[model samples]
Structure formats: structure tokens, C-alpha cells
Target: MRLEFVENGPIRLEGGRFRVRVGEREEVLEKPRLSLCRCGASANKPFCDGTHKRIGFQAPGGVLEVEGD
Candidate 1:
């Protein structure tokens, strides 16, 4: 299982437990691969609906600093 932040795109979660809850709703993934929204433009919350491209969303930095195992 791994989380990879693509170069200026959504974070991809592969072969991992993809569980997310926002308010009263929750998302459950049945696939081994999933792209999570980071640009905050996805119509599907917690999931990438490809809205970032239309909105031209950009992360301030190109690097992601993660500290966990």
C-alpha cells in the first residue's frame, strides 16, 4: 500500500485501505487504485473528479513532506 502525490496532480493510493468520511457521508473504494483530490476542485468529495484541470489548481510547493510509516 502506498500514497503517491503525482507531479502537480491528485494523490494516488494503491492497494491500500481507502476510507474517508466527510460529515455524514463516507467513501469506500472497491478498486486497488484510486486518485484522491488535493486541489479541492473535485465534484466528488474525497475523490478526484478531474475538476482541477478546469480550475487550474496548483500546489504552492512541488514537494510533499510526509512523516509517517
Candidate 2:
């Protein structure tokens, strides 16, 4: 499984259950496709609760820029 950030929107998850550590807690998901919140306003915590759509999130078009080469 792999996780990819979708510009300004959410983190896209592909494949099966992957482990993630948050603070001291570990989270495992069973879904193959999921959108994770990045704006820190999601009521659902790790998952996107459609707050981005309500807040009018404008994700960058098809390009990702990583800092510091």
C-alpha cells in the first residue's frame, strides 16, 4: 500500500491495510481507496469528512512540488 498527497485536497490511499502512527496510536484501514484530510478541519480525523468540498478546496492540477529538491 502507498499514500499520495492530492495537491491541496486529501491524501489518496491505494491497496490494502497499511499501518500509520499518530502520536502513540496506530491506525489500520481496510479500504483500498480513501481520501485523508489534510486541512486539519475534518471532523473525522484521519479521514476526509467532505469538509474540503464545503470549504471549497482547490487542489493543484496534476503536479506536486516537493520542497528542497
Lowest summed lDDT across 10 adjacent residues in model 1 is found at 59-68
| Per-residue alpha-carbon lDDT of candidate 2 for residues 19-61, written as tens digits (9 for 90 to 100) | 7777788978687777879778899878788788778777673
> For every model shown, what is its TM-score relative to the native structure?
0.69, 0.63
Best by lDDT: 1
Q: Put down candidate 1 lDDT per residue, 1-69, tens digits, no spaces.
A: 667777667887776466777999887767888888989878886889888788887764343445568
- Which model scores highest in TM-score? 1
Backbone clashes, candidate 2: 0
RMSD of each: 3.2, 4.9
